[model samples]
Target chain A: MFSPLIEDLIRALRCLPGVGPKSAQRMAMYLLEKDRDAAGLLASSLQQAVEKVGRCSRCRTLTEQDVCSLCHNPRRDHTLLCVVETPADVLAIEQAGNYHGLYFVLHGHLSPIDGVGPADLGLDLLGERLGEQVEQGISELIIATNPTVEGEATAQFIAERARAKGVAVSRIAHGVPIGGELEYIDGGTLAHAFNSRTVL
Target chain B: MFSPLIEDLIRALRCLPGVGPKSAQRMAMYLLEKDRDAAGLLASSLQQAVEKVGRCSRCRTLTEQDVCSLCHNPRRDHTLLCVVETPADVLAIEQAGNYHGLYFVLHGHLSPIDGVGPADLGLDLLGERLGEQVEQGISELIIATNPTVEGEATAQFIAERARAKGVAVSRIAHGVPIGGELEYIDGGTLAHAFNSRTVL
Candidate 1:
């Protein structure tokens, strides 16, 4: 329906996470028809990011530098490291603005059915970092992984490893969201909230 | 919260239609983390299309060549020309598969407020094409512009021009879609559907 290059552009656009064929076509047409300069900039930016962005050596979050700004910042509490499944999670925590500690991105949780394991998640590197707990003066490891089955399993695995290194491990609390109505809360979350209720 | 290049990539991804900051970040992260090769291909394809693709000389649709394949095709009915608002509309009609005629893309509708005149919509070129109606053997100009006020005004404007060239002009029907239920359909569409009822 379109020229070869235009068709190729649409197909290539489908690589984005949520873009399907129709959306990809719309995006390709919009770029070609309305915003060529933006398209050019996007192309160069994508290329540059693809070439430069890699996982931070310490935290495993995506970064262009050897050590990410968050990890390198001396003001942040390195003693309290938060473990998460992806860099996006790190961003979410940062946006929430309460955490003053550093982060360790696992990239993904352990999913054996999909063949994702500890090594695939750079757990060995995390283990090495945990081994240096005394030297690094890291007092606590916060497991901020999602509350899915795989996330719980990953948190448990990491907690065991942190305990082996004589470091305390804690999982972030999960209950009904702050503004959520109790009537609308799901059974699992309600049950957990009831069980983990603190004296308030 | 991301590195500089990653942040740039996210910002660039927002140039795509319907991509908000969150979606852009997800797209950027997905491309960088999951598929760098796809990202590279998307970048080159975007750059190539932006650099190489231009409006077809005859029809004004996007194409890499001098004239689009649809315009150059001998099998299509050149005597009937369907005028549309955008290349995406052209693709939509092409995908519907019943139209065997050629197309003329307006790129946009006539909007006096935004200073978009006939020249902006290539109406002068369309006029020239209509002038060659005698030699080209064109019998009808099918106006398939959208059913918006601007689209109707543009269609009326083009209809007058085609009439001056002694070419018959017809607007595509405005009615409820084929599979749509009357109860769920909008009042405007239902009213139009009744107004444009056929003899069936």
Candidate 2:
């Protein structure tokens, strides 16, 4: 219904994770009709980021630099490394403001059905890091992967590797979230909460 | 929490309509991690559209060409012109697949508080077109502006102008949507439906 360029812009906008056709159209119209300067900035930023951003060698997180700021920061405890499923998880943990250690982004957990495995997740590099724990000063590996079947299998696999290298491995506790009503909580979470109950 | 380029990309993505911080981050991650080609395509498409697309000379809708395809089409009914608030509104009517006439985009409704006047909406150009109606073959003006205080005011204002130029004018009907239930419909829409009841 729109011109070729406008239609192309709307189609391109649908590449975003959750944006559908209506939202894509709205965004395209808003950018064209209201804020052309913002549209220009977004275009340039997207181009530059796509050209420059890549996985950090140390942590496997998205970054323009060779090593991400989080992995390079000397203040963070290198001895404690938290493993997660994706780069977004690193941001989530940072926002929570409690973890003060390093992070290792797995990108994804093991999913054999789709052919994802240890090699696909850069597990060899993790194994090499585990082997050099004494030199790198990493003593404990905290598995913070999501509590799914694949996440559990991934955690177990990493734990065995860490143990073989004499590094302690721990999985983050999963239970009912703080301030969540017990009645409203899902049965699986409630069951996990009861089973993982800790004394005060 | 992210590297400079990634952070810049996230900030830029937030300019999109309805995209907040979290959604922007997710979009950025999905584009960078899962589909760099789509990201590059989106960036280029946005840049091209922003740089090339301009208002159609005849109808004021967005287009890369001098005149939009809709306005230049010989088969369309030149005797009837539908005036709308935005190009998006034109798309909406076109998608409904009934209107075969031409369109005139107001870009915005008149608002003295926002300093939008008749000249700002190219009303002078519309007036000139109306004055030359015999040459242009335009006999009827359809006001399809939204059903709001500003939209109604705009429709009324245009109706008076068209009438002054010896052209028949009509406003699009305002009533409950076809699929809407009376009990669930808002009071204002219900009242409009009652007021506009048809003989059928």
> Candidate 2 — what's its lDDT?
0.92
| Clash-forming residue pairs, model 1 | none
Task: Please give the range of 10 consecutive residues that has the lowest summed lDDT in model 2 chain B.
Answer: B128-137
TM-score of 1: 0.92
For A142-186, candidate 1 gives per-residue lDDT tens digits of 999999999999999999988998989999999999999999999
CA lDDT, candidate 2, residue A98? 93
Worst 10 residues of 2 chain A by lDDT: A128-137
For candidate 2, write residues A1-200 as lDDT tens digits.
Answer: 78899999999999898989999999999999999999999999999999999899988999999999998998998888999999999988999999999999999999999999999999998988777736567889999999999999999999999899899999998999988999899999999999999999
The DockQ figures for the candidates are: 0.85, 0.87
